[model samples]
Target: MEDFALEHINDSRRTILITAQLADSWNDRIKEIAPDFTIELRPWAKAADIPDELWENVEILFTLGAFPTPEQAPNLRWVQLYSAGANQAFTGPLAKSNAIITTASGVHAVNIAEYVLTTMLTWFHRYHQFGSWKQEGHWPDEHGRDLFMPEELRGKTLNVVGYGSIGREVARLAKSFGMRIIAMEQRPDHRDRGFLFPDIGDPEGKLPDHYYTKDQFQQALAESDVVVAAVPLTPDTRGMFDATAFHAMKESALFINIARGDVCKEPDLIKALKEKEIAGAALDVFADEPLPDSSPFFGLPNVIMSPHISGMTPHYNDRVAMIFTENLRRYLKGEPLYNTVNKERGY
Candidate 1:
């Protein structure tokens, strides 16, 4: 269910502060949605650039990074984040605010889920290893011809480590490829809870053949031919996938992480890769972005590393705007908002 725990606050003349590069069309759309409310589109470089007088009148704020001090925007009660992850939203001044925070959780779900499938297929066929053959201008003879044989995705089991919006989409795509889906969910969800993209994800949560809780974490890991980590980074989730979790997987299993880097222990993962504890890993998010030059992940032949960008697409901002507009309608009607962030849960 959507979060309705937040109480409604009303003002005769409300002001919405937006500090992102929004389109003229979107601004006009917001104006059309809330005709009486004063909307300010100040895509400023810093909070100081925004007039203090304007800050005092702000009731709602939409941003990716910009946040106001408690004293700066006393009237600010709602925050609409521009990204799927709520981790960054929980940091800085906004974390302490009583604002009813919402995220663009379903916006990036489609793109990130596609990234998961791409990596899975790439690893399964050992496509990256073919680069050496290409550079050498040599084709493997009959004896080594098996190296070029493609691995079929049919009938393979996929373990969705965290079954949120992104994982749901991943399962939907993998299902079409005839793969079995198992999900490790934090809660008992027979149906999807919040912010589903229009007919895109596993809305009924029926894709996964089996659902396991945190208590069955190791069992969940062992049941996969391919494991996709789509979990959020919370206090309970940080460093959750260490040696034991890796050890639980089948030796030939492929591990894929589109989630936050800290979710896996870097050294343990490297050790697992070195020992062939699991066949390989496809990592998008890293504990440290740009993945330092000294990092061992670069040298590991079995690891596929990308610069933490699994959730990007040309239409990204447009989808995020959709979520914001929907929430705005709900805000005006004093209804529950989608993708509402729970501070205690740290999603």
Candidate 2:
């Protein structure tokens, strides 16, 4: 680790190369914060067209879109991705490289967690159906018993998959709502690492009474009343929650996904909902962006869908910018970056 830190500092004329499409304000902001660092904006150049001269001294690559192959930038050391998910970042040649990759993992945790809770509450209270009732002025036609909705979250179990920063935040908020929380994280020694949440008695502890390892993921899914997918997309996680996994869940369980849509197969989810294998689902991301109008999810009564806006809060850009700026400082000081993604895990 110390040798890695030294390598970054020893590099000459540390250039942080960024893609063209990023906002001018973002470029100006980076320059403002790290005036000594050479911030290069390379636009209109294909990955192969990246000038060999630019690669000579470039130490860090602040990537927004698909990264150039490592062979294209032989001297590249660190990659700071704009997106929280590092699936695309770890592919083919890039995956085989030794570059350190970090993501904006925790940047959207609070906002996305809030979105999950809001969607869950909406489903629990039947807000959309109630709105339809009011619009039709049909409330008086139904008896009180017929119109009453069943269940609340007070004692229900919320199983959070992939106990990263976002998962921890979701667990903390769920616990505050008097809901039982179960978390599944990747680390074998997660309890001792204190990364997602502190130990049970630690002041920073955010975990609930029960936590599960990768080996126990199936058990967690079986007992959950609400299953929240907060896991990152990786080779191992692609289509992780397929038809068989859905069948393992309780018939009345509500599923919420704030993670990548590709993590769950679209056809499998549609089939599960249509066959009543699961109670309902709220999805904020899709395998395809701007979910096609022909998609079956749009017409499903038991499905709640959004246009991948779970992480888009009022201050989203500001929050992302802050994280990037702080990371720039770390990059300059030869310090370890935050939210570093494991290349092998691809998250």
Among these predictions, the greatest TM-score belongs to 1
lDDT of 2 by residue, 1-347 (tens): 11336364555586878753456788898998877678888753455666777876667776656466666677788877767777756566567667877776666777888888888898887775677668877674546645447578899999988777677777877787899988876565544221221221212434666877877777888999999998878777889899878998999999998888898998999999999999999999899888899999989988888898888876655555666677777766877666677655566
Question: Residue 269 error for model 1, in Å?
Answer: 0.4
Candidate 2 has what TM-score? 0.84
Q: Name the top lDDT candidate.
A: 1
Q: Indicate the residue-level lDDT of 327 in model 2.
A: 72
Q: For model 1, how does the per-residue alpha-carbon lDDT over 1-347 read when each residue is reduced to its tens digit?
A: 45565454476667988887777898899999988789988774467788888888888888887788889888888889887889866788887888788988888788999999899888888797798788889878899988878788989999998888999999999999999999987676567777777889888888899998889989888878999888899998999989999999999999899999999998999999999999999999889987899999999989888998888799987888888998999888888898888888887
| TM, every model | 0.96, 0.84
Q: Once all C-alphas are superposed, what RMSD does model 1 give against the true structure?
A: 1.6
Error (Å) of candidate 2 at residue 111 is: 1.2
Worst 10 residues of 2 by lDDT: 194-203
TM-score of 1: 0.96
Q: Per the 3 Å backbone cut-off, how many clashing residue pairs does candidate 2 have?
A: 0
